[model samples]
Target: MSRGAQVGVATVYRRFPIKEALLTEAFAEERDRTLQLLLDLVRRAQEAGALRRDFVLEDVGLALMANAGIRAQSPEVRAEASRRFAA
Candidate 1:
């Protein structure tokens, strides 16, 4: 992990002692970026006239949650660190 990500994990660990808690907190950040990627996909779809403007952020979020590789190291730990990637 990069220094920034390491710091984020450290902060999370400080806030929550358990690794599972820390990973869950980190996963939320991952989810947000995944949601953004979905938003971009939606924008592209709209530009291509494939998706209607009626599509909302929630829809994008759901799409991302399903398609994005948001896998956890373990079911309990929920480590989405693999999703912490460079663009």
Candidate 2:
């Protein structure tokens, strides 16, 4: 649950209708962590003069498509990934 504490299904389902909703909620923290890792890597590369200054959003998107787990997901997932990366 959002409280980060374990609770029974009766309590959880009282809030969420389906299991996927709960999964998506739980996945949010993980997604944030993954986004932070990717962003840190990109920022470090830029700071270290390894990433080109002219690199644009498309380049970042390609990198995510190549290296991120989002390659297999749908457009909505890609949009979420883009939003996460942009954050």
Estimated TM-score for each candidate: 0.45, 0.55
Write the residue-wise lDDT of candidate 2 on 37-85 in tens digits.
8778877888899887676545766765655655535888777876676
Give the lDDT of residue 76 in candidate 1. Answer: 46
Model 1 shows how many backbone clashes?
0
Per-candidate local distance difference test? 0.68, 0.74
Pairs of colliding residues, candidate 2: none
Angstrom error at residue 69, model 1: 21
Candidate 1 — which pairs collide? none
The residue ranges of model 2 lying beyond 4 angstroms of the native Cα positions read 1-6, 56-61, 64-87
Error of 2 at 41 (Å): 0.9
